[model samples]
Target: MVEKVDLLIKNGYVVTMDKEGRLFKNGAVAVSGNRIVAVDKTSSIEQKYSAERVIDATGKIVMPGIVVSHCHTHGQASMGMPAEVEMENFYDELAKWWWPFLEDQLKKEDVYALAKYAITEIAKNGVTTVDDVMEAPKDLPGVLDAEGKAFLEVGMRGILAFEATERISKENGKLGIQENVNFIKKWNDKPDALLRGVMCVHTVFSCSPEMLKEVKELADKYNAWINLHVEESMYEVEYSKKHFGKLPFEHLRDIGFLGPNVLAAQCVNTSDKEIKILKEYDVKVSHNIQTNMVIGVGLAPVPKMIDEGITVSLGNDGFYLDMFETIRTVYITHKGVLKDQSVLPPKKVLEMATIDGARAVGLENDIGSLEVGKKADIIVVDLNEPVPLNNSNIYGNIVSFGMGKNVKYTIIDGKIVVENQKVLTVDEEKVRKEAYDATVRIWTRNGFL
Candidate 1:
């Protein structure tokens, strides 16, 4: 008897980023009801399973969907604007430009519109799962809800949060916390929802110790993942020492806030002792390579972190949504900084983008790699390489030559979200127009227009 499946993808080179690193030249994946039923050689899958829909992935590379451990869905509006500013460092840019722009000019409509636009771009870039931090304290009441709506409309999977910070005011901080809590309670029980809520503390400098403790307690109560920035700049470390009388990681550890569920971004200035503490607590790190490079923050000690058995994953950090560029940046950044060509091999970088990233976001068993019974989050990349794409050259081609524009299909939760490089769930042009209008409004409000 033949088994029936909802979809069958065949005739591709499948890179199953599993524990054993399995690869099949002529491969196929069978999906049934949002779960992968089987992954095997194309002939075997074709003979055993009959499907209602089939995607002939000829001359394509099929792999697990890219996972972004940290991103800012609301920062899409500020993408190109930061580049034009001549600033000394990240702190200067944040204080003189970015923070003022966000706190004063960002509106509710801007959040919603930018989210739709961001998710659309992310889907096109082959990112299926994202951990998004929404930071617009001025637009708090339903800001997260609006972003959630955008994610649902775009048919992408996301773990969303409102970055609660006490720097603005006690009332504003309370509102931010309430926003995250309310969104979590509202969506946590929903059946088969694609977007869920996570807890976010902006940073140690912005969030008081009390606020951090309270957020940690809330995460513990709800059993949720906590995403936050940690030691992203020298200023943050200096501030932590000045205020808390200890390093940021030390203070966090002393407060009992470090844990396996915490996803800390940046860590560019972490010390050896701090790295040890991170390893001891098993906290995950989200490496935003492009953002760090663009902002001139020092490179993260990823090679050392990996050696210590720390879980480090790739993230865009709202700099750009393209995971392909992120992967390449991570690959070459470490190599160039360390002056060693052997660091960060292509295969390892790919793993960071996919499997390691899923683990960072606490979705390892569900959506990381192409495994049976895992959620069907997959992408098809058209290599379009001049040289032959075989087992040995596949990773090199992906890292060096591939771009997000080469993504032909993005599938999330057994649904085709992007087909032929176009988003299917939302109106692309309308989203783009609204995003542009919102950007203009925000720029005008900030006097940048």
Candidate 2:
């Protein structure tokens, strides 16, 4: 009475970072179309289900593919732009570099090209899902439209949010919110869509209370999520304290903006009280450990937050496309900062990259762990390389020494997006050339090269 498997991956060491954290040696996973129907010993699976296609993952580790909790992949072509010379203050970094780049220099062709390139890049690194928090122009720019189009073209599963702001004026905030509403309406009912809609209020500092409520209402009406940056730096905490007589999270709690649907990125400056508030509101945190270290911001209290029942997930924070590097950074940085090797165990960090990240994006039941009735978003890593295959500490090797180069395959929703380190959905070379050329042009146009 056994059903046939559409695909079977045999002879791999499977690390199912499920709630129970199970591991199976010499295991096989039988996939019935998009869902993993069975995970058992290799001998048992071979006896039960016949496979149309078989992947010999011998001497490899099979696990859930990574989900990047927050990424601005639309900025792939803006990689090398100079840090603003006059950006002494936090707000100035936005005005001089990020906002101007979005408003003045980017073209539609560039957004399309950049998105195409970013999708392939992340997939090659074994990342199957990403939350692209795109900051579109104040007016609906051609490039912003193309960014969405490119995401659709690349066939990457994601949630797209138009970064909304009231910084220019109250009218501009309403316009930004409307843009989000329009995009959400366009794709709300599409079945089998890899993309979902989100309303991104840029940050608490940039949006007015009315605009925040409007965004919340729009997201609720569409049953979509709201993504935003919160407590990213020291000044953000001070600004909230000065303006509202409370910390940043306290301000959000008072205004009723903290909710399960709200994804708050980068709580690097959050206090213990703020962590408690986050746990109460069920707010998810996208911990960008590398970006914080690079930007000289203090480390996030991730272990404390995790202990407080706040769901902390890993994010790249626009630093690199490789999720492996991000995972390594989180594991090492938290341990170093806390002065305890036992702070963030490898198993916990692995969960952050997989299941916890899916929970942050509210897709836990659909595609996090490799379980029955869940979408087969899986990656195959070659363990015969520098990654030692010793069974004594295979889990530690994966988090510490595993690199993106070791990833041999990436599958999303039962479809092979990357095989043998090559992207199947698009021309990799063409996209890379376009991204590089566009970066040069955008930089020259802005006089920042």
Candidate 3:
């Protein structure tokens, strides 16, 4: 007798982000509960497992859902504010814009409404997982509470960390650490909770040595992931040189901050010595190609870092959350920056979005691939729109030509979160309205409007 399946995605091209990088034509993926149980020939899977729910993915590319490693989603409401005329550095950008918006204008009710809005938009873009470094208030307990409630209400897979910075009094540092610990304790071992606690020290330049050590120790005590920004710009690199007499990465290494448990968001200004130290310390890199190019920061040495056996995942920073653009940026930027055409191939770029991204968030074993025993987190892209089949190099073509509109469905943890380009969780129109309203309020409060 054949085994039963809860859901089956039938007759699609399955892209498996496995060690061998497998792609199966006319494939069928069977899911039992949250885990994928089989990937085989369509006819064979139908013969073996009876599906309770079936999705006809004909002429669509079924692949792993996008995983965003690091992002300031706490500022999702303030995304499109007009650029200030006198913006000088990243610190200025955060302090003048993002920080004040979070501290002053962001209402308690707005957290849930905006979170739902952000998650809806993100899911529509086929992003199933995100590591949201939330902006915590310097003197407010309610802000942290509101953020936790927002995460719980959305019911999405995410890593939430407090955005710790010493821009305020040193007492806020202790409060930030306590907030992380309290949140971790509350949701420590919940089976169905997809939210994980993380330690986020904004960046090396913004954090004092005491602040960095405190958060690191707290993270270790709770066994949570340490997410930090490093070498994101030339200014940060220069600041470290001026202040600590060492490069930023070296300063982190000397202070014993870089580790396997840490996810360094950006290293746009990293030196060869920094990359070597990163490899030695087993730190993961989250490459935000779009953000780097937008800010005119120097491009990361991605090809060299990958060749050195370092894992580099794709991220969008604070702007666009689309992985397709991120993947394209990785491919185009590296080739152009290196003056070498063979820098980041399509297959490798795809890996960075899928498997490598999963590894960055510490969930590679669960999702990130169409493999048995993995969670059925997948997206089906409609290929019929931009017709004229190119099956010969379809994988490469999908990366080059595919957009979020092509995503016909987004499945997360065995549940279809999006179908036919519509979000299943929240009211789309309401969320969009809330996002717009929040944006206006944030701008007015920050005097940006």
Candidate 4:
């Protein structure tokens, strides 16, 4: 008298990533609709339930889908623009090239293609959920809707917002504020929405204290997440001391801006005292290891943050969407800097990409792990290794060798969104062409042609 389910993934090494760090050597996950009905040994699942679809995950790794804690998918189209220019420092790069030539040049019409193309790329790499901040100040009103349409088209999960700030004119900043409110209003009560909204600010340097408090109030009203960059560069620390006579996180704390709702990205220039403040407020850190290096910013003290018991998660910062690289970089970079190979082990890095990430977006109960009654967001990775891939060595092998191409299947919400390294929700060829068209249109406007 076995029950029937929609999908049963069998005979794979299932990394549960639960509190006990469970691993089923020959595991199966039974899905009923969008929820996981059971997770146990394959033989147990075979006796307990029958499925409409069964995937034989032989020689593959079955785990929770990667959750990107921070992203700027809008910048996907601007990749490699101003190719000949050297970015000497963080502020100049953003002020001169990134903010002006890219965010300013991006038009409303280009949102869908860039978002779709970028989201699709991340999806195929086993990213089921992403928290994104759009920066198109030139087209603020209703532009987040365009991003929503792109997420809907791809059938992935997104927490969307326009990075609201007062760096521009106060009027434009008000527009940014209104845009976030509008988006949040639409997603007010939809807890299970495939596309959700978060309130975003660019940085403390870019946003006023009053503006920061305003966003916090609205975000609390909706119980929504608030994301922003903090201590991503040394300039922010210097700016705070010169203006407010305190460190940056202290400024946030004094203004009553530090809270559990905040997902702060890149604590690269933060001190140990700042880490304590972050822990006090229960703020989560989104580590952008590669982006910090590429932008010439200092490395985040992720090892210290983790050691201090703060929830540190991994993000691309939208410089690149490769989750494998993000995971690997965090694994190796900290060890090199600390000169301690024991720091940021593969297992911890795996948690940063999955459960810790879910915690960052406040979706830990839903999407982060492969547990019973959780959302069925999972990835089947085929490392294609010639050696043994057991539970003891699996975490290391995947972290060391995994790539987008190795992701043979990406299952999100009981639906197969990507299979055989191809995205199934949208037309790949069509997206490629439109994405290129949008990039060209943007580049032409930026005078990069």
Predicted candidate 1, C-alpha RMSD: 1.6
| Models, CA RMSD each | 1.6, 2.0, 2.1, 1.2
Give the best candidate by TM-score. Answer: 4
Report the lDDT tens digits of candidate 1 across residue range 43-133.
9998899888999998999999999999887677776664355678667877777778764577788888988898899899899998898
Task: Tell me which of candidates 3 and 4 scores higher on TM-score.
Answer: 4
lDDT of each: 0.89, 0.81, 0.78, 0.88
Per-residue C-alpha lDDT of model 4 across residues 294-361, encoded as one tens digit per residue: 77888998888898899998889776788998898888888888899999889999999999999998
Cα-based lDDT at residue 406, candidate 2: 88
lDDT of candidate 2 at residue 237, scale 0 to 100: 81
Q: Give lDDT: candidate 4, residue 9.
A: 94
TM-scores for all candidates: the values are 0.97, 0.94, 0.94, 0.98
Q: Give the alpha carbon lDDT tens digit for every residue of 126-169 in model 2.
A: 99888876655543533345766776665577777767787777
Candidate 4 regions with alpha-carbon error over 4 angstroms = 83-88
| Candidate 2 residue runs with Cα over 4 Å from true position | 102-104, 138-145, 385-392
Q: Which stretches of candidate 3 lie over 4 Å from their true place?
A: 82-85, 101-104, 142-145, 151-155, 385-392, 447-449
Question: Taking the tens digit of each residue's C-alpha lDDT, what string does model 3 give over 1-449?
Answer: 88888999998888887887777788889999888999887899989998778998888888899888877664677656675646788767666766765644666666656666777777888888887776655445555566666555554677777777776767776676677777777775775566777777777777898788877787778788888888877888888999999998888878877788899988888899888998998889999988787777778888989999898998877468677877777888788878898887888888888899999877888888889999888899885655554446776787787787778889888888889988777678887887778777667766776
Better of 1 and 3 by lDDT: 1
* Candidate with better lDDT, 3 vs 4: 4
Please give the ranking of all candidate structures by TM-score, highest first, separated by commas: 4, 1, 2, 3
